[model samples]
Target chain A: MLSNLLVQLINGIALGSTYALIALGYTMVYGIILLINFAHGEIFMAGAFVGLMLVTVFKVHIIFAFLGAMLFCMIMGVIIEKIAYKPLRRSTRLAALISAIGVSIFLSNLANLVFGAKPTTFPPTEEILFKIQTYELIAGAQITNLQILTIVTSAVLMVCLQYFIKKSRIGKAMRATSQDYDTAALMGVNVNRIISYTFAIGSSLAAAGGVLVGIYFGVVKYNMGFMVGLKAFTAAVLGGIGSIPGAMFGGLLLGIGEMLAVALGLSSYRDAIAFGILILVLLIKPTGLFGTQIQKKV
Target chain B: MLVVENVDVNYGAIRALVDVSLEVHEGEIVALIGANGAGKSTTLRSISGLVKPNKGRILFEGSELQKCPPHKVVEMGISQVPEGRRVFPLMTVLENLEMGAFTRKDRANIKDDIDKVFAKFPRLEERKKQPAGTLSGGEQQMLAIGRALMSKPKIMLMDEPSMGLAPMLVQEIFNIVKEINQSGTTILLVEQNARMALAVANRGYVLETGQVVISGAAADLAKNEAVQKAYLGV
Candidate 1:
């Protein structure tokens, strides 16, 4: 029983890591522009399809496929930002949000038209990469190599992101832009370029998450991004909307909580469980777990 | 050297500045003194490219700045320490100072400039790692000035540097302003504290509503009866 629970925990963490990756994009774009890119989920879906295409059509290795998907989605994200979000920036918040939803709908429908509405099986990871390998922990709990890879990759990516934001010149400019846009421009940071870079980075991270999800679940669908994107957004809000660490923490917590609900014989209520936790967290701490209360000056 | 010639600025339907002109020559501390809502800050904003003038031109070393964006203005060597010490509240003091030099390619010299800022405001050095928002008001103001200095600008536009400070801190800030001017950067300072501003300024402009009602040498302006009656509050 203990080992079974441990296995579930490992699965939960792997799932959570992917959510965290997607959530980072949401949090970052929201942080810098104060616009919720609702179409982000579609970007994730687009990434999975791109990865599938690279693998099936291009006959590339798994690593190359993953990278190809990321690069393609990065450009796609930038294009979407420039086309859909950029022109509406000075307009009302509702206008940008509606634009995001419109793009989301448009992208999903485009993917559906291209890939068909049915779920397509991904090229099996075990066949493409290495043989299926599971390590047995104490008490016979098993952890798969894929799970390990997912968690480690997520950690590394997040760490790199943190380092870039804290130490690099462009990253510092991002933080400044996030804190105050006008002040950043006044300091000679090109605000528009920073916004584009932000969208590119966020979208690429979401794409990476998409590719990983395809490998883990062994399938891809046109609309898979909708539910997962919402969950990841919930994770972002759960941790604190604009805080990077908060998104990571929120994603892990949501993933574990959902898995644990299933472990508790509530598998039927899995979807309900995720939203329930979001509602509860919002009710208790509206600013979120890691969100700071910003004091406005006169 | 900087020049604003016959500039007019409007906000929606409201005219903020009307036919205003001023000049700051190289190596001089020129003060623009006026009451609240007298377009002092508006003029600075116009100069910094935060707001565009409806008419006329702004020249920095014979180059037009009317349509230049804010970042390009900074790249052209004009830096403004905006009102309320608008530092990046979440960033560390060191980061805030680093942002000031954002336009420069002298990566190696940035550290030296940072050290120079530290020497100017030792309190900032002591709290270098702390967030700018966590600093006391005076320290935040000091950090604002220090951050602007990081650009190594040719002319610094300071908007209400003495605003909201205690009298002693205000005096301290004005002293630092003088020292900064002595070190070779020209200054265009806007202030409500007319006495202190006039004391430090080589020349002064008295703005009423949106127009420059009085302009002369600082000493002469300070001695003017009408200037004393209105802005100087004698």
Candidate 2:
């Protein structure tokens, strides 16, 4: 039973890596503009679809398809920011929120229109890193290379992001604009350009998450982003909006919590388990685990 | 040099400034002093492109700035340390200073300017790694001014630098303002603290209800009976 728990923990890390990737995108977008891009999930779904099309129809290599998917998603993120959010900036927050929802619905239906309502499969390839080996002491428990790759990739990406934000000029500009847009603009930082770049980076992360999940699950669908996106968003809130490392921690925690709940015979209540963690965390720390509580001036 | 010719500003139906005209020459400190809500800040905002004027032209070094954006205003050698010391709260003092040189291409000179700001405000140097938000109000004000100075702007637009500082800090800040001016950068100051403002100023303009009610040399405006009774509390 102890070995089983260890195997489950390893599996949870892989699942958590995908969640962390998606969550970073969500957190970055939310951090800078405070606008939740509802279509972000659909954008991830579109990325997978883009990758699927490249591999099947165009006979592109998996590696090239992944790059194309990221580029496509980044461009889409920029357009959404420019068209949907930028013009309505002067409007009420509610208007932007509603428009975001509109973008989500529009993208989901557009995917249905373009790709059709069917699950698309990637070309058969030996993409699995290694076979899962079960241990006797951990009876009925197993681990695989896929899991290790996911965790390692997630960790590397997160560390790279942290370094970029801390040590780079554009990254510093992003943090400043996120803190206060007006002040940043007055300081000669181009606020709009920074926001667009933020969306591009966030979307690219979501694309990476999409391609990995597609490789793991073996089947890509039009609606994959709905549940995963929701979960990733929950991760962003759990860690704290605007914190780079917080999203990774939140994602991994949420993934493990879900996996453990299922492993312990509560499989039916997995959604409840995920939400329960969110509510409990909010109760303990209203601002989130890593979020700094801002004192609003009257 | 800066010139504002018959500028007008409005928010919805409320007129914030009416035919406001002002000028600041090279190597001079011009003070725009008034009570609360006199639109002194608005005038500065207009000149800095933070707020657009409804009528009239703003010319900076012979270029019209009707459609210029805020950062472009800074690139034109005009930097405004806005009211309330809007420092990047989460950023370190050094990072905030670096933001001041965002538009510049001289990476080496930018580093030197940062050192210059630290040299000017040694308190900031001690707290260089600390977040700007954690600093005292006076320190944050000094950081704000220092950040503006990082841009190497020819004309500095400052609004209410002494608004919330204690009397001692206020005096110290005024002295720093005089020092900054003496070092060759022109200043366009907007302040509600009229006495200290007029004292450091080369010339003064008293704004009332968005209109320039009185304009004179600093010493002349300080002794104006109306100015003394209302602003100086004489």
Candidate 3:
């Protein structure tokens, strides 16, 4: 029984890593502009479809396909920002938010039209990369190589992101802009370019998450982003909207919690459990577990 | 080095500045002093390109500045130490200083400028790793000024550098202002502390309701009976 639970826990972590990848995008964008890119889920879907096309049409290797998807989504994210969000930036937050939803609808429908409404099967990882291999653990528990890859890849990307934000020149500019937009501009940081970079990075990370999810689940759907995007957003808010580490922690927790519910014979209500935790966390700690209270200066 | 000519600014329906005009020449400390609603800050904001003027033009080193964006204005060799300091609260003192040189590419000079700033404000050097928010009000003000210095600006526009400080700290800030000016950067100062501003300034402009009501040498303005009664609280 303990080993069975442990296996479920490992599975939960693998799922959580993907969610965390998407959640980072949400949190970073929100931190900079305070606008929720509701269409981010659509960007994820776009990545999966792009990945599929790269593999099937171009016959690219799996690793290159994954990277190609990320690069494509980065451009897509920047284009969406320019077309939909940029003009409404000076208007009102509600206006920008409505625009985000509109873009989200437009992109998903565009994907549906291009990729069709049917669920497409991802190329088998065993055929493209290494064969599906498992390692036996204590108490006869098993861990797949794919699972290990997903977790490790997520960790490496996250660590790289953390280092970039903490140590790089542009990263310092991002932190300053997030803190105070006007002051950053006064310091000669091109606020517009920084905003564009934020969207680019966020979207690419979401794309990476999309490709990983497609590979793990072995099925890619036109509307796959909607549910996963919402869950990732929930994880972001649960971890504290603007805090980087908070989003990571929140995603892992949400993933594990959902899997545990399923393990406990509540699989049918997994979505309900995930959302219930969001509502509970909001009620108990609205600032989120790691969110700091914003102090308004006089 | 900087010129504002008959500029008018408005916020929605309200007129914030009416035909405001001011100037600061090379190697001079020019102070704009007035009451709370006298449009003092508006004049500085206009010069810094934070606000658009409906009429007239701003010339910085012989180039039009009226349409320039804030970042471009900074690139034009002007840096503003904004009112209330506006330090990035979460960033360390060193990081905040680094951000000041965002537009520059000279890495070695940037390091030298940082050292110069640290030499000027030793307290910041001591707490370089601590977040700016953790600094006391005086230290934060020093950080703000030090950060501005990192830009190696041709002219520095300081808005209310002495606001919300103890009398002793205010005096110390005024001394730093004089020291900075003597170090060859032209200064355009906006302050509510009329007496202190006039004391440090080479020339003074008294703004009332967005128009320049009085302009002359700072010593002359300090001695004017009308200026003393209204602004000096004498």
Every candidate's fraction of true contacts kept comes to 0.75, 0.66, 0.74
Q: Give the interface RMSD values of the models in order.
A: 1.1, 1.9, 1.1
lDDT of 2 by residue, B55-161 (tens): 99999999998668887888889998889898888899999999988888888889888888888899999999999989998999999999999888899999999
Which candidate ranks first by DockQ, i.e. highest?
3
What candidate 1 gets wrong by more than 4 Å, as runs, is none
Model 3, range A182-212, lDDT digits (tens) per residue? 8899999989999999999999999999989
- Candidate 1, B1-234: lDDT as tens digits: 799999999998998999999999999999999888999999999999989999999999999999999999999999999888899999999999999999999899999889989988999999999999999989999999999999999999999988899999999999999999999999999999999999999999999889999999999999999999998789
Docking class of 2: medium
Cα lDDT for residue B108, candidate 1 = 92
Task: Give Cα distance to truth, residue B215, candidate 2, Å.
Answer: 1.8
- Taking all chains together, the TM-score of candidate 3 against the true structure is 0.98
Residue A133's lDDT within candidate 1 is 91
Q: List the candidate 3 regions with Cα displacement exceeding 4 Å.
A: none
lDDT of each: 0.93, 0.86, 0.91
TM-score for each prediction? 0.97, 0.96, 0.98
| Sort by TM-score, top down from the best | 3, 1, 2
Per-residue accuracy of model 3 over B169-230 as CA lDDT, tens digit each: 99999999999999999999999999999999999999888789999999999999999999
> Given candidate 3, what's the lDDT at residue A42?
87
